[model samples]
Target chain A: MNERPIHVVGGGIAGLVAAITAAEGGAPVVLHEGGARLGGRAVGSAERPWVNLGPHVVFTDGALVRWLRQRRIDVPLCGPMVRGVRMLDDRGARFPFRQGLQLLPTILRREAPVDETFRAWAENTFGDASADLLCRLGGLITYHHDPGALSARFMWDRYRRTALSPDRVRWVAGGWVSLVDALAERARTLGVRIELDDRLTPESLPDAPTVVATKLSGAGRLLERDLSWPGARTALLDVATTADPGWPAVIADVRSDLATCCMIERETAADPAALGEEGGHLIQAQLGVAPGVGVAEGVSRIEDGLDVGFPGWREAVGWRRAQIVVDGTGAVDPPGTTWRDRPSVEQGDDVFLAGDAVAAPGFLSEVSVNSAVQAGRLALDARRRRAFAPGWPTAELTPERRLAVLAAVLPSAELTTTTVPGADEVAPVDETGPGYRIERRAGVTRATAATAGKGGVRVTRVVASALPGVARAAVERLPVWRRPFRR
Target chain B: MENQVRAAQGGDPFAMDALLTELAPWVGRLCSSIALDKGDDAMQETLISVLKNLPTLREPAAFRGWVRRIAVREALRAATGDRAIAVAEMPEVAVAPDFETAVDIRDTLTKLPPSRRAVLVLRYLEDLSEHEVAELLGTPEGTVKSGLHRARESFREHWREA
Candidate 1:
C-alpha cells in the first residue's frame, strides 16, 4: 500500500498540477487522461495558433503561475493591457463596460434582497432596463448564459474575487497548450507516469490514494453517480483574421447573449513560424448560449454576433473552426447551489477531489490549481504519515533535483535570450543580424525581431543580471548563420 | 450476469469491469435520486464500498439488491451529513407555477429536504413500495409512509399556490 502510486484522474490543469506536486513531494504518481491529449478542454491545435478551445488567459499572480515558477518553467506572459470593451445596444451604439469595483458604487446605492436570483436582484435594485444591461454584462463576466438562474450571493462572491484580487490578466506566450505541454513534461520528469486515452473504472483504479480531477460530470460518471450541479454550456469559434482587431480581448453585449472576442495574436508572444507564412491574426470568439439552444443555431448566432461586432468579419476571416462545449468549466453555482454547497477536497479517506468544481479559494482556474495544490499536499501528507512514524526524517528535494525537473520540463521555443552576470548593460551577441535591435536600459536587455510584410512582433527580454549561465547556454545553442530580421 | 459477479468476486479484473459497467448506471440513478446534488460523490463511494465488500456478498444473485442497498446507505449518509434535516421540521417552500413549467424534475426534487426527498425519490422515482423504501432507508414503515405523505403534500401545496 505504501509503495502504490497516487492515481490522478484527468489530464487537465488540475490533474497535471496535482500529479506534479505529489511526485515532487516524494509520492509516486500516475495521471490518467481520457482524451487523446493531456490538455483536456484547454488544448489548442496548429491550425488555431494561440487560441485555445475558448479564450483562456492566466492571471499573473495566479497559483498556476507560482507553481510554474517553483518548477523553474519559463512561460512568457504579456500584459493585462487596458483594451476597449464596449456594450453594444441593438442600434449599434457602443458604451464602455465597467467591471470589478468600478460598478461597486452603483451596487451599494441600490437595495437588493438577500438569497434572490441575480436577475431578480438586479431588476429590484436597478429597475428593468438597467437589469437587462447588468445581467448581460454579468453573463459576459461569469460565462453563464442565463443570469436569472445564477445566485446573487454567488455572483457577488465571484465579482469580489475578480475585482479585488491583485492578480492581473495576462496571456500565456504560446497559448494554453504550451503550458499544458510544459506541465505534462514536468510530470513525466518527476517520475509521474501519464496514461493517455485510458478511462478509469472502479476495478481498473490504481492501488493508491486517488484524486479525481476531471470535470464534475466526468467525475460523476466515473463514480457511477448523478451529480446535480448545474453547468454552463458554450460555443467557441476560432477565427484567423487577416488584419489585427486592435484589442487584446473584449466582452460585448449581443442583445440576446454576451459574446467575448480575444485577439490572440496581439496578446501572445508573436511566433511567425507557429502563425505560419500567411501571418494572419488569430481571434477567438466565445458566445455563451442558453442551455436548450441547439448546437447549430448556437454556432450560427455566435458567428453572426461576431460579424455584427466586427463588420465584414466573414471576408476578413481566413480560417474558422466552431465547437460546442458542454460542462466546459466545473459546476456553476446556481441559485440554490452557492459556494458553500460546493464539494470539499477530501471526498473520502483515500479518495481526494480537485478541479474547478471543488471548493478552493479564488475563482475559475485559480480555484482549479489551488484545489489541486491542496489535494496534492493532502495526498503527500497521507503518504508520509503511512511511510514513517512521527519524528522520522522524510526525503527533501535538493536544488540539483529541482534543476533536473526543470530541464526535462521546459519546452524549447524559437527565440532564445540569455542574461549576463554582474553586468549593468548587456547587448545581443551581434548574431541576431540586421533589423534586430538589442536595447540595454536600467539593467535590462531587450532583443526584438520583426519582419516586413509579415504583420507580427516577437520580443525576447533577457534578464542579464540573473541566471547568466542559463542565458549564455541559450545564446550558444543558436545557429551561427542568422536570418536577417526584417524591419 | 451471476457468473460474472461470481468471477468478479473471485478477483477476475475483466469480470469485475463488466459487472461494474452493467451496474454503474443503475447505481448512479439510485444515488442521484436519493442524494440529489451530491449523487456523484455518493455513487462513487457506494461503488467503492460495494467493490471492497463484493467477496463477502453471500449470494451472488443478490448483487443488484446488494448494490442498491449500499447506494441508498451512501446517499443517505452524503445527503444528511452536517446538512441533515428532521422529518417533522421540514421547511415551508413557496412553489411558483412558472417554476413547475420552467424547471426540470431535478430542480423540484432539490427544493425538498434530503430525507423527505430520499423517501419521495425512492417511492415515486424508483417505484419502490413504502415497505421497501422503509427497509432501504433503515426506517420504520410508518416513518416512510408519513415522510412520503408530507413530501407529496408539500409538493402539491406548492403546485396549489402556483
Candidate 2:
C-alpha cells in the first residue's frame, strides 16, 4: 500500500520466517542474506554425511513444530534415539543418564541468601564434594567453561525447563541444509524475493519496515549501533566412525572441560557399504573454550577429550573436520542479562528486530522463530494501520466512545471511562478542563481531550475517512464538552 | 503506584493500561524463567486472569505479589500438570560428592518433578519464605518443609551413588 516492499535483512531462520510471514500477509517483501547460503549457523553440506555447522535439532513441542504445522509443510524427522544422555568420564567410564521421569531431584529446596554463583548454591545445597561436580556439569551442558561465574537462578531456570517437560528431540531426515532449502522454497512460493551474498548497510536499507535478523554483531553493523553482549567461543569437530557405540546419540564428557560428543548414525542418509573403509556412522565433538584461546589449542583439547572418552576413537574413525565458531548461537545469556534486558521486536517506528539475541520466550532456535514471527506480525499490523485510511484525519475518539467499543468487544471486562488526549498522535494537546482540543494540520483533524490523565486510555478511529458521513453524524449527535475547535 | 492501582481497580481504563504496561515485563520474566518456551502464553493468560479479577483485589499495595502468584501458577501449569508425577519417581540413589561425577544440576533438575521445581524456584529464585511459598501454593507450611526435605535427601542419595 505504501509502494515500498518490507525489507528483511539476513537469511537465517529468523529472517526467512519474517520474510515469509510478510509475503504471506500480502505485503511485498525482499530478503537479503550476506552468506552464500541461507540458514546461517544451521548450514550443512551435501558431501558431508553427518557434519553440520553445529548440532541442531528441534524439540517435539518447539516453535518450529508449530510454525511448520501452521504452514502445512511436511518434512520427515527421526525421533530421538534415546531420551537420556550418556555421560563419559576422563577414564572412559560410561554412566547411564536415563529418561526415566524421576531421575532429577529439585536442587534449590532452601532459600538462597542472595543471588550467587552456581558453585556457591551447589556447595550450600549438595555439600562441597558434589558441588564441584555440579559446577562442571553445568559448564558442560551450557557450553560455558566456568559455571562458577554463571548465575544460580539462570542455571536453575534452564534446568527446570529441561526437566519439567523434556520434549523428544528430532532432526530433519536430511541435514539441516535440506530444511533451509525447504523453507526457502516455501518462502519463494509465497512471493518473497531472496537475494543472497548481498551485505546490507544502513544507508542502503530500503525505505520500508525492516526486520534485522542477523547475529548480534552483524545486526549491529547494519543498524549502525554497537549491540555487544557476552558470549562463548567453541571448537567443533565432525568425525566418521566405523563401529557404533551402541549408546545414545549424545555422550558428554562432563569430566572434561565442558566437552560434548554426538553420534549421527541414525540421522545420516549415506550408505555404509558404499563408503570404502569408514562406516556410515558419524560423530560430532564440541568443546567450549576461553575467549582468547587459539584455534590450534582448542582443536587439540577437543581431540584429547574425544580420545579420553572413547579410547579406540581414532582407530574407529575414517575422516574428520574441525572449525571454530564465534558467538555460535547468538550471545550467551550471562548474569544480569535476563529476559528483561534483551532487545524487543520493535526497535523504532519502521524497524523490527529478530534473532536468538532478542528478548524472546524460548531457547535457541525457538527464540529465533518466535521473535521473527512476532516481528513479522508487528510489521504487517503497523503497515495495515498506515494503509487503513489515506488523506484523512486520524481521529482520537473520546474515552466514552472507547469504553463503549471495549465493552462491546470484551463483554467480560468491567467498563469505566475518562477523557484523555491520544498519546500516539504527532500534535501535543493542551492540559485544560473537560474539553476537546481539535487541531487541524495538513487536512487532518487531530483531536485530544484536555482532562485526560497521563495514564489515560487513547483510541484512534479511522472511520473519519472510511465512513465520513456516519462519523460526522455521530460526532454532531454526541455531547462533546462545550469548546470551540482550536486552529 | 498505589493510586494508579486503586484507580485501575475502580475500572479506570487509563490506570489499567498503565499498570498493564508496567507489569508486562516483570510478568514476562517470571513466566519465562518458570515455563521456558511457554512463557509468552503463560504471561498472556496471567494478565488476562489478573485483569478479570482485579475488582476483587482488596489491597492495592499487594498488587505486585498478587501478580507474581498468578504468574507462577500460570507458568507452572504451562510447564507441566500434576506435580505428583515427579514425586512418584523419586529413586533412592545416593550421589557421592566427587569431582568426577557426571550429573549436573541441570540433569538433576530435568529429572525432578514439576512440583519440586516449583518449590525450588520459589525458594531460591523468588527468595520466598517457606510459609510464603506454602501460602502461595495453597499447601500447608509443614507439607512444604517436608517436601523440600525429601527432595534434598533424594538428591543427596543420587549424588552419593558412583
Candidate 3:
C-alpha cells in the first residue's frame, strides 16, 4: 500500500468529501483547515446550537444523500415537507390550482436547450404567468436574484428535480452541524490527519496529490489562477419567536415579477427539538436581492411577506438577524454555459479543485459532493502514478505519462514573489531520489537544477515564477517546448 | 453527451476542449498500444483529425466508433512510417532462465509489423470480431482471418526458438 499522503485544503463539505474519499481509497490523507473548525459554510458556529448561516435542505434523491447513505454516515433527517406548503402569488392569493396545473404539463415537455435563457424558453413553452412564477420560485433552489437569465438547461434540470418529486427534499434534522460532525468522524476513522488553522498558499503547498476545496476566489489566489464562476447572492433572515403559532411549514412569496420569491421555513414545525429541550420556533427566511439591493431592503420585503403569511409574527419575535450573503449558494450557470463550462476540477499541479462552483454537475451542495468525489479519484490516480514511477527521470513524457506530470507540477506563476518554504514543498522525497526542480517562465516548464548523481537525483533549486498566463495556457498548453532538465 | 458534441460541432471552443479532455485517455491508450514509440505522434494526429472532422460527423451516437477507426488508422500509419523495423531483427534469440516468466506483452507487441500489431490489437485488445476488424481496417475478412492465424503461429515459433 502507498503511504504517500494526499493533502486536502479547506474544511468545507467539498474538502471533507475529498479527504474521506481519497483516504478510503487507501491513500494516506492529510486535511488542512484555515479555520479551527471542520465545516466551512455547512456549520455556521460551534457556539450556535443548530442554527446555520441559512436553512439548508438535502434531497433524498440528490448526490449528497446518496453519497452519505453509501458510506453509512448516519445523520438525522427531517421530513420531505409535503404538508402546509403555502405558495403566495403576485395577486396576494394562494398559488392558483389552474396555473399550477399548467406547470405540470411542462414536466412532460421536451428537454430545455443549453444556450437559451430559461425565461425565454419557459415563456415560450409555458405561458408568461407560468414562466414568471417558475423563475421566481426558482429562487428557493438557486438563491439567485435573476434565475430567468440563467441557462435553460440549468434551470430546467433543477425545476424537474424539485417539482417532479417534491418529496425528495429532506432537511438535516439538527442542521448541517450534525452532518459535518459525521463527515469529520468518518475522515478520522479512515486515518486522515486533520490540521486546524493551517492556511496553505500555492508555493507553500506540499509536493503531493492535493485537493483545493476552498471557495473559487480563494482557490484562484492560492493557485495564482483566475478560477471563477457564477454564484448566488441572497439575504438571509433568522427569526426566533417565543410563540409556536400554527404557521405553514414553508411559505414561498412570489408576490411580484420584479422581485424574486422569499422562502421561509419554520424549523420548529418540522423538528420540535430544533431550538432546544424547551422548543422555540426558529424560522429562517431567504430572499434573493438584485444588485444594489441592501440586506435591509430585502429583509423589509421578506418581513412584508411574513406579515401576510405568519400573522402577528413581528410581535411574537424574540430575536431576529438579517444579513446578505454574496455568492454563497453553489453556482449559477449563465445563458450559454453548462456545468462543464464552469471552472474545471483537474487544476494541473498536483492540485485538484473540489467545490460547488467547479466542473462537476449536480444541484446546489450536490455539486460540491460530485466535484469532491471526482477530485479525490483524480488525486488517487496521481498518487498511484507517483508511487509506481518512483521519480522517473524521463523528460520526454508519453501522452499517457504526461497525465502523471499533469498531476505533478505546480507551475511557476508567482513563486518568485512568494518566499519559498522548506525543500519538501511538493512532497517529502528521499534526499537521494531523482527529484527534478520545477522552473517556469512564459508558459513553459523548466527544471533549473537536479541534485542527483552517484546516490540518486534530488531536485536542488525550484524557481516558481512566471507570467499570469500560466492559468490559461501554462499547464493545459505547454507549447511542446517544456522539457524539464535531464538529471 | 450529445449536447457536448452538438456544441463542439457548432464551433464552441470550450465544448471542443471538453470533448478533447473526454477522449484523450482512450485515444492515448489505443494509439500507444498500436503505434508503440510513435504513440505521441499518433495521438496528436488522431485528436486533430477527430476535432477537424467533428462538424462532418452526422450522428453523435456513433462518435466512439468513428474515433476508434481514426485512432487505429493513425496508429498503423505512425508505426509503419518508422525507420526502426530492424531494432531486434539482427539479435540472436536468447531464452530466459526463468521459464515461467510470461512474455512482456508490450515487448512482444513491438516485435510484430505495424499491420500485424493492428490486427492483434483490434482482435484481442479491442475484443472486435474478425469481421469487425476487417471492416474497420477496410480489408477482406479472409485477409483478417489469415493474418490472425499467421500471427499466432509466428508468436509460437518465436517462443519455441527462445
Best by DockQ: 3
Q: What is the TM-score of each candidate against the true structure?
A: 0.55, 0.56, 0.62
Number of the top candidate by TM-score? 3
In what order do the candidates fall by lDDT, top score first?
A: 3, 1, 2
Per-prediction TM-score, chain B alone: 0.78, 0.68, 0.78
lDDT (tens digit, per residue) of candidate 2 on A1-487: 4355888999988999888777755578899998777887777554653356655667655567656643546666765555335566555535444322123445334223226776687687767745655556554345566655666755655554454444456766566666677889889987889898888888887665789999888878878877766656667777766776653445566554442222222233222322223445666666667778777887777666566555577887777777778777554556555543677777887688888778665556777887887787667656644542211111222333333333432323334333344432221122111232322222222333333335543333211212356555564355432222111
Q: Sorted on TM-score, highest at the top, how do the candidates line up?
A: 3, 2, 1
Name the candidate, 1 or 3, with the larger TM-score value: 3
Give residue A20's lDDT in candidate 2 (0 to 100).
79
Per-residue CA lDDT of model 1 for A336-369, tens digit only, reads: 5554477777876667788887766555676778
Q: Model 1: DockQ against the native?
A: 0.01
After superposing candidate 3, which stretches have Cα over 4 Å from the reference?
A93-98, A390-487, B1-162
Candidate 1 Cα outliers beyond 4 Å, as residue runs: A45-50, A70-72, A91-104, A107-114, A126-128, A163-167, A245-251, A254-278, A385-487, B1-162
lDDT of 1 at A199: 90
**Is model 1 an incorrect, acceptable, medium or high docking prediction?**
incorrect
Candidate 1 clash pair list: A418-A471, A419-A464
What lDDT is reached at residue B16 by model 3?
Answer: 49
Highest lDDT, which number? 3
